[model samples]
Target: MGALDVSKIVQGRQGWRLITCIWLHAGVVHLLINVLCLLFIGIRLEQEFGFVRIGLVYLISGFGGSLMSALFIRSSISVGASGALFGLIGSMLSELITNWSLYANKVAALLTLVFVIVVNLALGILPRVDNFAHIGGLISGFLLGFVVFIRPQFAWINQKRVAPGQETAPVKRKHKTYQYILWLAAVVLLIVGFTVAIVLLFRGYNANDHCSWCHYLSCVPTKKWKCNSSPQTCTVMQQPNTLDLTCDGTGTHHSYSIAGATQDQISQLCNSLCS
Candidate 1:
């Protein structure tokens, strides 16, 4: 029930849709894709980092995705967990980097992961896909991974394993200096990014106003297909015993003979006419 409706969010102040929309999907195909991806990517991360960190990455990343989508795509409704899925992908990349020494076949793993990320992002440019969400989730999760996934240096870990009271040189720091620097920088960036995005969103700033070419990142027109940015609407005219409907997108008209019809019925009829 919680598909993202931009008007409800901006005009009606229903900000909670940003979170609720993540758990909703447009159709069975959409739900299956998200669920399968979640199982494939989430299981390993949850096993390694536990539920808390993974859950945080999921929810925050989903919100980040919704915020970006709201800013750019004011028309139409959006629903799905693609943003959260991208966040997991982003976190995997950052985790590999932050814990580079702990992993084997570093170069090979990095290449494979990079390839996968690039391919998925490329797919976002297609029509009806929200690339902005993918991008926002990725950035949020990448920064978060550095902060939450920092591992202790091997020397520090070995030092802890030493027998009690045994003579051992002190491993001055648990984590490398670079890790600390990255963690701090990532935290600061995350705060600043979220602050700016929220402020812009509440102020009713449309990202499309500033970036003319940004829409191409979400969809590109081709000879066989075209992108539709306008929201679906219908103009209704009612008489005592008949109703007339006109689709705003296509200007197609339909007439129904009925004594009276509720709003939901009218909406369903309009949708059918538009379709």
Candidate 2:
């Protein structure tokens, strides 16, 4: 099956992929890592806020990450719920800050969450990792945390204090107006970012069909043919030579030599073509 990719998202307008990509993964390892993180973070969040808000955090944060990834990452068919997971982590941090008065051990909670975020973000700097999505989801989730992760008032009140019809005053909603403005600002930025990316994509800006300079993933620097060049033709170190293909009235001819062609490429290509 075709992967959820930027080409389809932008050029084909498959807007659903922003969320759908979270459900895809490169391999079993990718899937398992995401599942573990989701389980750890999701379970806690679900118990606190229920499924609805947690689900919103996952999806909205995933979309935020994917949108940003699409804007700058044109060559990869990125898949994984890392963005969504990171969003949960981000929202957890913001939630702690917004509800600082509620937590029994605010310092410990903040430190643990901060340590998790730092380690994950540090790992993202490795090759083949996507840090952009992490940052995007993080920002989006942090802003959204203010709006979605409202502390339950009843949970904060003393259970034994109630004797009769007397009502317990709910915890003061400490969410400042500036915090809400920040949330709105995040939403506006996301909308504008997506709109501009779509416009640029339609205006003829596209990753080269082969993504020649993108990375080893985009063009597997092997003895293969690509647009206007062969893998061997790339001015890279220790690149082997290519096989010669000639067809005339006489017959098809294939030539190989140690100088230009390696034994493996010659054997493989010859078997595929001549055999």
Candidate 3:
């Protein structure tokens, strides 16, 4: 009843937990946030597409979120509908774009939607947030939105272009060659990205250290960092003002020894550990 643990999903092979975890909430506060977000985003989608389509999007996006969390976070037990909430946000973005011609103030609506999505995702930088789920749900929802929300006229199946003055059909739209190209490109990129992400996840890549571009997102430079790769032992330095650290490993255990004096070369000694 708690949540789905990544280890169980991976090593224990409890796949049913993926969907079950989405229905569970971490706490009352978490439940409130998801409910509010669902009301805001889910209701509108349901109004337009009806209950069935929106429901499918929510569940599918949530499942996608859980799948990514299981793959990336090996030690976490994740619960909540926030991933699905982000999915709704993503769906709205694609919906707006797919039906852009129908809207009068496209730019304003788009800006507002983008601002909200950015703010929510930025807030995910906080500790304990399941950002991987949000990201997975978002990408899945965005891609699905294009296919799920296409209007009948502008849809690829029926293509007809009408001039400014003359219109035999109620809606005048053409299936442009570029739209098909872009959609194909998006699918290719999505598959490639997911594959790369899985490879890096198994490679034990720390986004904090390995991906410098993402350093600005969730990591902050701290002077209090300590060397955790090896245990340290200090030795009085023969030299008066210099410090040196050496590392050695035997079997599985690793050790680091520092050769230096305190106060005389304290800054250098401490800096060596952090560096």
Candidate 4:
């Protein structure tokens, strides 16, 4: 098909942009890296669990990453399948943890994979990669995999006698109370984690420094007491009056002022009055 716009995919008026954005990416390199990762990890998972389960994991993990990004990174546009790929990796790690017996050498393989990913994460700190999304996806995938794949049950148990001559001890079933506790803990952790992510995202996007009033005028410290109403009506305030004033970037020209106060002083006064 044709190229897709990530902003369009994720820019819903209400909030559904989170779902659509995961499928879109910025460029060829971006698309290739994610696709390769997915192909390697996702295909294997699908083969084991069937397509439906794999699809569910991908969707959930992708959405989790998008939600986190939307809440945290407001200025820059983000588009990629890296989050979903990371989630798949997390799932693979979980599978290794849960079924160590069936999958021989899984522990070693997982450790290697973990090492590679950690190094990549460290590299991500240098520049443009959205490390937060990668982390969110990985954690979400890991949690989902643990819940779905590792439910407490003894899949292997020997109860019947192999032959009449030989008697064997009945295999005892291990209590799954700990597993249940772990499941509960995982659920609680996921909820708390997502909540914290959302809060931080919102806080970061809507920082006090990005206030409309503060950025509108470009007044310096020395000319703090001047108020400019418009291009024509630049006025210097005799006293510090808490009124909104618009100023050009330089102190030479004040765009306009609401009262006889500097923009900073006006903002403070407004906050105090509102409070």
Candidate 5:
């Protein structure tokens, strides 16, 4: 039931929408895409690390995505699991980095992952897509990977394989020192990032005001398609049998017969004219 509505979040203080929105989608196609992506990327993660950690990454990354979209695009509604899906992708990237020593052909794997991430992010720049959410989710999941996906070193694995009571030296720490450092740094960064973003969102801070070019990340104009991100505003004059609409932004005027027309119908007509 929850969709990311900026007014509801800021005015009504419905912060839970940030988490709940991830469960909703704009349409069937949106839902199907996310499901297939989750199947492709998430099942393997669950098998490798189990569901609990991956689920945490999904939910928290979704919240981070919602917070970011709210800050940048405050005029529209957003609903989808793409952000959570992007989180899984980000987690895969970080998982590879954290477990670098475990895999052969590391360079090829790294290059392939980078290519996939870049292509997906490039798609987000199209109109009506929420790239802010994608970026935010990617960052959150990337940091979470360091914290939750830390693997035991090969030395630790070898030590564990030794027979009981035949140990020559003491058992080494399970994780490397660098892993602990990365884990701590990631934890601090996630905490700080979430806190700051949440505070700014509740305060109704529009990120566009600070970064003039940030909107281009979500949409770019092209010859084939027009990218209009601004909201439409219109004034209406209604009579018993007719209605007149005037777009405030563009000063375009149109009229339509409203005989026996419902208010919802008139509103929809006005929106279409304005858009």
Candidate 6:
């Protein structure tokens, strides 16, 4: 019914709800948009890489998208398959980019699709939409497709038989160096992605006003009647020969003497406040 209710359903008790939530849309408009995009991209990818492989790519990419969104946008509620759809689009683009000679004509079509989707994604930066999740899904899908789907090159060896002047060629092994490189790159990207997600999770959790040390050292003291009761209060409580002690909302006190402290000392004080 509401965002909170939906969040509860999506978050669930054990967190398995994320998988279903991605498929379940909040409204008709949301369902239609995501379904249309999925149909367009999924059909093309299935044709190229068979149903099973395409399904795998979609599932993994979707998981990556949801994981990123959960880590980064903690307070917001999201439900859509757009992230997976975008992943399919990214896979198609990567395939075309890697083998341009084989798909020269298709490049124009792919580029047109990318342009349209990118414009739509750009619009998402305004509010509601989890553009970050879309981006994570797209990148993960592209990387997975590139790493797993490319054809390998094989070498042949010739052998001669003395009996009847017959010659045969021995099958040679295919090299997988390129695939290994791709996998390595994917791992690196995923690691970086998760790190960003962690950073975003904790961002803006505590406002600057909540830190008494910062208020004491950085914020200018005000003499207004309302200032004393406010969190901005920075009055010195004790005067030592070398330093001045101060108190704020948090009883933890700090000492300051000079007009300004060194960068390292300021950093240490801020860290203590946060801790």
Model 2 TM: 0.64
- What is the C-alpha lDDT profile of model 3 across 122-208, one tens digit per residue? 876555677778887887778767756765434433324545665354433454444455457656765776667556544544343
Report lDDT (Cα) of residue 98, candidate 2.
Answer: 68
What are the per-residue Cα lDDT tens digits for candidate 1 across 208-230?
Answer: 65665676777676666556645
Q: For model 4, what is the alpha-carbon lDDT of residue 195?
A: 79
- Model 5 per-residue lDDT at 153: 79
User: Each model's C-alpha lDDT?
Assistant: 0.85, 0.65, 0.64, 0.58, 0.83, 0.57
Give one clash count per candidate, in the order shown. Answer: 0, 0, 0, 7, 0, 0
lDDT of 6 by residue, 1-275 (tens): 22312235333533454455467676899889888878877887788789988887787777667765554443446677767877787777766654444554786778786896678666555434666568767877888777656644333222322346665555444434655566578668767865664354335222233344332321223343221233332334333333343333323445666554555655555344322
Which of candidates 4 and 5 is the stronger one according to lDDT?
5
Q: Name the weakest run of 10 consecutive residues (lDDT summed) in model 4.
A: 246-255
Question: Which structure is stronger by TM-score: 4 or 6?
Answer: 4
Error of 3 at 80 (Å): 0.6
TM-score of 4: 0.61
Off by over 4 Å in 5: 165-171, 229-275
Candidate 3 runs further than 4 Å off = 153-179, 182-275
Error of 4 at 97 (Å): 2.2
Model 2, position 240, has a per-residue lDDT of: 49
TM-score of 6: 0.57
**Model 6 C-alpha lDDT versus the unseen true structure:** 0.57
Q: Candidates' TM-scores?
A: 0.82, 0.64, 0.66, 0.61, 0.82, 0.57
